[model samples]
Target: MGEIRQRFTDEFKEQTVRYIQEQTKTIPQIAEELSIPAGTLQRWMSTHRKFENEPLLDREAIRQKDKQIHDQELEIEDLKEEIAILKKAMHIFSKERN
Candidate 1:
């Protein structure tokens, strides 16, 4: 009798790939631990290798970027308010001199 084929979900595959990437364990060791074939894990790793060189942003980094953007937006609003106030002041001064 032939062995039934096992299927894994995309989430499982992605977590497994991330684990393989982050762990110090060898592929064979991880495969054995997970009861999956080394070849399957290797194939997943190979597919992920394409984006391995790209920098992945962690949650903290993303949060910091978001804060920076928010701060910049506030600064922009403040500058716009200052510009309007300066323009109003210039108009008042010109009227007084006229």
Candidate 2:
């Protein structure tokens, strides 16, 4: 396999990660849209959790975080639904073939 190379600067990485965290899109979707690895964005987000001074999160920011959490929960539900559908389809197909 070829080595992976990074093309974006630190500012770009930070902005992309912040956008990913704040947006309604799933991590996979964000990665696909931004052309960055989901794992890389995920790791960046983990690192961001240790901010010493975040300028004191305002009520709006708190609301935004709540929204982000809700969005992630929805995404997880969607993924679970998709997995269930796939499993059901697979079982039916397997029975039909047997």
RMSD in Å for all candidates:
10.8, 14.1
Q: What are the per-residue Cα lDDT tens digits for candidate 2 across 1-98? A: 99879777777777776676566667899889877788988887776543533343378978999999999999999999999999999998888452
Model 2 TM-score on a 0 to 1 scale: 0.44
Best by TM-score: 1
Candidate 1 lDDT, 1-98, residue by residue in tens: 99999998877888788888777678999999999999999998877544453343478878998999999999999999999999999998888552
Which lDDT values do the candidates have, in the order given? 0.84, 0.77
Lowest lDDT 10-residue stretch of candidate 2: 48-57
TM-score per candidate, chains pooled: 0.49, 0.44
Model 1, position 22, has a per-residue lDDT of 72
Q: Which pairs, if any, clash in model 2?
A: none
